[model samples]
Target chain A: MAYLDHAATTPMLPAALDAYATAARAIGNPSSLHAAGRSARRMVEESRERIAAVIGARPSEVIFTGGGTEADNLATKGVFWARRDADPGRRRVVVSAVEHHAVLDAVGWLGRHEGAEVTYLPVDGTGRVDPAGFAELVRAHGDETAVVSVQWANNEVGTVQPIAELAALAAGAGIPFHTDAVQAVGQVPVDFAGSGVAALTLTGHKLGGPVGVGALVLGRDVACTPLLHGGGQERDVRSGTLDTPGVVAFAVAVETTVRAREQYAERVAALRDELVRRVLAAVPDAIHNGDAEHRLPGNAHFSFPGCEGDALLLLLDAKGIYCSTGSACSAGVAQPSHVLLAMGADDARARSSLRFSLGHDSTEADLDALLAALPGAVERARRAGAWKTPR
Target chain B: MSGGVDSAVAAARAKDAGHDVTGVHLALARNPQTYRTGARGCCTLEDSRDARRAADVIGIPFYVWDMADEFHASVVDDFVDEYAAGRTPNPCLRCNEKIKFAAVLDRAVALGFDAVVTGHHARLGADGLLRRSVDLAKDQSYVLAVLTRAQLDRAVFPLGDSTKERVRAEAAERGLAVADKPDSHDICFIADGDTRGFLEGRLGSAPGDIVDGRTGARLGTHNGAYGYTIGQRKGLNLRVPAEDGRPRYVLSITPVTNTVTVGPREDLEVDTVTATRPIWHEASASVRCDVQLRAHGEVVPASVTVAAGELTARLETPARGVAAGQAIVAYRPDPGGDIVLGSATITAGTRESAHA
Candidate 1:
């Protein structure tokens, strides 16, 4: 089986699994004020410190949440609401056009339900946000801006953003910047303090940790509202009893993935490059997307001409090669990729795009299996034509 | 799959038959839950979820394919156009013809699936003919008559032999949630059961004269001529009775003149009906067939003549409520039941009064 959808979620590392089993066997919620609770709290704190150290943030700034989505919701809504409350005039939300649905939908909710003026910063042909363009938008909004958000790298296209430049510019503009680093954190060098962003969202499952455990590395001085109000945990930004086992497993995965970042990226990038090169070689018209030099080491995205992505994906799935389409959909009709469209791709190009991401488990054999199935699948999909109703 | 008890049981039966199966719910609406849902709806989020649930129980992969764009173009747009052209369109038949059999089946075959399976209540005979389902009351061969032989070749109806009650019972036995879910009723698109309100929103109001067809006496006015169908006795709101003190019935709607012709009930009866856009299951120049006018309305003996693009059927006895733009499906009455031959959309009709 060739699993190329690592950006969706990777298999948990052995160390994380062991940590989870060990932590789960222990008793007591971290919120309880007893001996067992103290032990649990210690484990949670140690996990937080370990995660913070690896991601370049203070231990106190690590606010654990359910997962990447919750962390993103906390960052977008939490900061936007807090900033709007502090200054009623701050009603504009500026985010990049390529952000994940977590940040995009949350910011959209603010626009629709909370009466905020939402603006999406566009991307270039490579799906990268121009630092200058974003800074200009933030400056123009000025006092009306509640928050600015741009991801470290796009999940679908893997185009890395000029994060430090954009975040520092937003910081200079006196508006908090939030980066959804869910796809960036183990794939690239992520530093909370160095990036100059008020909030960064990272989840475990995307790397190798247990699902349903993630953290929002919020700034100490940043005032953010809590999404869930209960037990007043996680600096009052995120509430609910911490998943002691899940947190332990998540921290181990983060520490391990971060520690091996350079070597892992080198190996996975080589595999990804081979897959991209061979796929293009076999299917000559397949156009590779994203910035080659400035992308996640494990990511390669492409759009095959005259082929619908869903049909191709299903054909590959039949042969046990799992990948993902960059395009979202309503009902069964594939909607063009918002990121690709923002990057100036037409509907046809966006509809034909697919993403294949490598990880710690990806190998040459996996790529071999993919190449074997791809050529025929592309041929069949092309012959099918773009899912138009057969008259 | 519609995510109903019949479909759930169909999926279960297909899985049990050992063919590799994947269940899909065709999403025919642009927006989910926008239409008022009763027992029946074209596409609802709840139905999609229920289908997925049944798939989980049956251990087959499930997906909801968004065919809304195709549905809008083929079914929804045609519906409005037919009404605007003063014809009563059969959206259900159009859906079966274009959506399930064409758009969806084409995609499935391209994606390497041998056939597209559904929970439709119709049987495929061993001799490669489309036959009425064992559960005759639930037989949907009338709507399916629009499907060509190519569609029937790759279509599977797992609940063909089972009654609706038996399908529901099997679903309950299999622990499916939609076992007790009511069978869909009325038109799926018209959620509130208010066809006029739905039509007014789309066609817009066009005031027109409602006149007596025979005597040429102006009866009343109508908001829009398209809002009335042939043989419709309600929604005209005309106060005066006919010449013989008989009730009034809408005999014809002429959108060009924006005039609705109402007369005695006998005027609504038609002996010869001319239908266009013919699709034949098996080609024949002429045949003695059982003709169904409205869906689940009735089947009457008719002699049908088939041409390249048209079908003309002369009913043994004139049938009432025969309207243009509706489907006139031809079927051969088998010893066991009836076999669906093909169908055409009604384009013209010779009323009993004209014949007399």
Candidate 2:
């Protein structure tokens, strides 16, 4: 199979797999204080240090959680709750329009059930939140704003946000800033201290690590509530027994991907650009989504004018090629992408878009297969008619 | 596959027939578990799992395609709109025609599938016609009649030749757990068996008069004309009885005037049923057919004619309780065959004595 859906989850690096296998054989709970426990504790701490060093975070700031969603929930709810407790009037949650459901839904829950006033900072046509637009929202409700969350990059459109500038704007307003860097870390430069954000989220699977492991790099000065409260590990922000094997593998994956990011981006981005070129060459009117210069090296999203993305995805899947559609179906009903809507595209365009993200294992050969299969799929899907949604 | 025994056995039969099959259980509702919808509703999470298990036992790929939006638009909304106009609409017929055959089948074909397969108890003849299921009790050709030539040409009903009893038996032999799963009944969208409440919630209450169709005298009042069906005997809450001491039955409902006309049992019988939206299997011409009104109701012999975009049928024997918006499926009844020839929606009907 030509697997170009790496942004969804890439294959685990072989070295990371080896690290997990080795750690799995060792039996010790990192929480316990026995000699065997101390050995596991050492492995967890060393992994923490390795991840922190690569991401430019303090080892103490990296709080491991089950995955990216958990880390995101902790950041939004924990920090928002803490900040609200510090001052009850600080109930405004400013999140970007293009955030993944992790941050979007968390902030939404706070607004709905917790009485938070949410101001969704809108993005430009290319799905980018200009620093000025974000700044205006924060300033308009600066005193009342408890938290500001703008993702490092959008997962769907692959438009990298101006995170440092946006984070600095929130900081200037004395508000807690959290960026979900899950998709950005391995593909871009993400430094907690360098970006000046209060906390950030990263997951292992997206960066070629094992699943069920991620971290929330939080500043020591930030007082946040806990999502889980059993072990009080990782500075008490999150509470769960450390998955030693997962942590070790995650650490290895993060270090390898981040270190190799520069050369990797150049190689993969060149191929992705060529893919965009060839796909457009095959289907003349196909529109590329997101800002061309500002997207991730591995990301190539397009909107075929008359095709249903899900139908196209499944059609290509039958031909041994894999990708993702921005639109997600619930009960056989496909909903147009909110990100594309925020980008000012109409509903049909939003529903027609698909994402093809390259990874470390992706090659020109994968591109060739996709290019060869795409035109026929698009033609068939168009003939199928834009997924007949309910009137 | 719907995770039921019929679909499960049908999938097994298709696979056994040396055809590559992918079992799919359509998620017809967004949140099936939230409603106390019972086994009748197709969208329950349990049903999806059952389909998955059947696929596993049969060693075929399975998927739950969410078609809730299409169903809601095509079938659910149509049910509400038809009732609001004081007509009894068959949601099953709408689902089969619009969602299952047109929408879902079209997508399957476009995705490279040669045919759309379902467990509906109907036969796809080699002549490209749909016939009745072998099991008359389990026959579903009434709803299947709405499908056109294109849909039937690319459709596969694997459970047609076999009886429901044998299908269940095959399912048991195949180790499919839903072998004894109860058949889905009634309108699937109307979960909880509260059709009145469901319609009330959507159309709301519109008070109107319930009058005797013969005397034109008001017999009682009704909460909403939309809630009443043709030939309904009970629940009218009439304050007075007929002069002949016989019970009253709803003869017709006029939505524009919000009036329901109730009369003696004789008024309910109609010898001639004129229907619109004439859909033909082939050409439009006069032919003798066994016409079925309800999906499980009786089929009476009728001579049907098609012309000027309308279909008119004269029943050999007067039939009662025929309602507008219900499908009138015509079946070609030969000595050894019952094939669905065509169908139309009942728009108007007259009593046998009216013309006499």
Candidate 3:
């Protein structure tokens, strides 16, 4: 199958795989005080420095965690907790409506179980959060606010949010700003120093690094209370036995993916434009789901009315051309994409959206395969959606 | 033509009978995602796709007319309102009456279809009267009781003469993907296995009191009385224990008072019921027949009387737990077995078990 769900995960690069294999051969936990442990610890520190260098963050700022989900939770809840502790009354959290469930569900938990209040700032139809509206909210609730978190780019609709502008508003309030830049790290230009955000999250799986490893870059001045307290790993913020192989692999992937991003993006964007053109020519009135200009170069989302996204996806899958309904995470739930709905897509449009994401590995042949299957797929899918009702 | 199993099969049969037929499946889900969530039923994406695929296999043109907004306005909203009013609503009957035969079928005729076909288990008489299907196990007359004659005139049911098993066999023979598809039993939208969860999710928590039916003593706190139906037994979460330790059954729900009354199972039984908006399958008036309250409910002998405003049914053997907001589908026996006389919504019923 021509896999197009790069938003979910990607194949690890040869360099990353070699880095992991080399690190895996070494023995000893980094925490132990013995010479073997010290040797392992050196490799981990070296990996951290490589990761920090590419993201323009200091070595001390990189805190390794389980993966994207953990990084998102720590950035969202840990920062909220830290801010709340610094000023006991700073209990409100501002998050964008288009956040991944890792961030969205954590904020929901805070609102539901914790005493903290959460305000979901609405996004425009393009899935871009209005920085002005966020500023208005921050100014209005400046007293109770703990932090403002908006993803760097949506995993589904792929609209890149104006994080620099959004973070500037939160920064003015002296509130920590965190962005889950999991999708944006390699695909788009990202600099921790340039973005001026207090903290940022990036995962390995989405950018050709092996799964189960990610990092949260905490700015020098940012003080986040540790979510996991143990042997004081990752600057005592996230304490766990380091996965040296995974960390090394992650650094290699980030370095290589970011370096080649420009050329890769140009190629994929051309193929994506063609995919959209041919899809529209085949299925007229098929609506694109996000802002055409602001969307990810690799992402092409369209809502084919009179057809269910799931059914269409399955049909495409049968043809060995795999895609997704909206996001891979919520594939089986059968609810209209909350992200699409928040972006002002009506129920029909939300139900009809199919996301086709590309990556460095994507090629013209993959696009051709998708285009070949799409026209007949849309027609059959629409026919299948029909219900014979009584007159 | 109602877009259902019986009608779908009838359309195929009619086509097989060498008649020109077009199959149409109405887009009745306000959002197909609601019903498709966790694979609910024939309302699912898979099912709709299956129906369309069957039409395609039969070499017929198929179309899906958007009736979602109308379905929500007519069926889903009414269902929530009825539950809020302390009554149990049958959404299937409402869909059959309001969307299937009435609304989409009207649109089908407008689009130049000779008639609408469904997979309903009810049969039509030689003189063109609606009757119960030959297969009693698959009879769906109860849900179709509310469909009007004018609506029925353009309706067809191919599965009426065949049993569900036969339908499956035929589906298998034709290589139809959904020929052996499992019959959908629950409400399509509420796939979380909790109607209360759906209500709570949509309507934010409304604090209410759960009280003992006899003493009026507060038994527990309920999120909303609107979430509880007349005969619901679960989710009471009562702090007070019954005398016999049996779970309490819902006896009444007073939305105005915001109170849910709970009592022993015996308190849920009802003997008599009055229904409104009756439609006859064979004639304009009433007759003696068997009434089934629920989809799987057994038929009980009853003398049915109908007027322009309402229909009164007095069971020969009093029924039990006959809650309000249920459809009263009547069935009369003929050469085909049982024919549907039509149906109405139950407005009131006796408080105790008439069967007991």
CA lDDT scores, all candidates in order: 0.87, 0.87, 0.79
Question: What lDDT is reached at residue B276 by model 3?
Answer: 80
Per-model chain B TM-scores are 0.95, 0.96, 0.88
**Model 2: pairs clashing at backbone N, Cα or C within 3 Å:** A331-B66, A331-B67, A332-B66, A332-B67, A333-B66
For TM-score, the strongest prediction is 1
Tens-digit per-residue lDDT, B1-356, candidate 1: 78788878888898898989988888877777843366756577777777888899999877777777888898888888989999998888888888888888888887778887788889885677888888989998888888887888888888888888888889999999989988888778777777788889998999999999998988899999989999899778886777688888989999889999998887778889899988887666799988999888888998999887889999888898889988888889887658888889888778543555
Mark the 10 consecutive residues where model 1 chain B has the least summed lDDT.
B34-43
Model 3 over residues A133-161: C-alpha lDDT tens digits?
A: 88888888987898778899899989999
Clashes of each: 4, 5, 38
Q: Candidate 1, which segments miss by more than 4 Å at Cα?
A: A329-333, A389-391, B34-36, B281-284, B351-356
Q: Model 2: runs farther than 4 Å from truth?
A: A328-333, A386-391, B1-3, B20-36, B44-73, B175-180, B280-284, B334-337, B353-356
Model 3 residue B331 lDDT? 77
lDDT of 1 by residue, A1-391 (tens): 9999999999999999999999999998998899999999999999999999999999999999999999899888988999999999999998999999999999999989998889998888998888888767876786889888899999999999999999888888898899999999888999999989999999999989999999999999999988899888888777898999999999999999999999999999988889999999999999999999899998999999998887788788878999999666554556788988898988888888899989999999999999999999999998776467435
lDDT of 2 by residue, A290-327 (tens): 98778888999999998878778777877889898855
Worst 10-residue lDDT window, candidate 3 chain B = B33-42
DockQ of 2: 0.50
For model 3, the stretches where C-alpha displacement exceeds 4 angstroms are A112-122, A130-145, A168-173, A305-307, A327-331, A381-391, B1-356
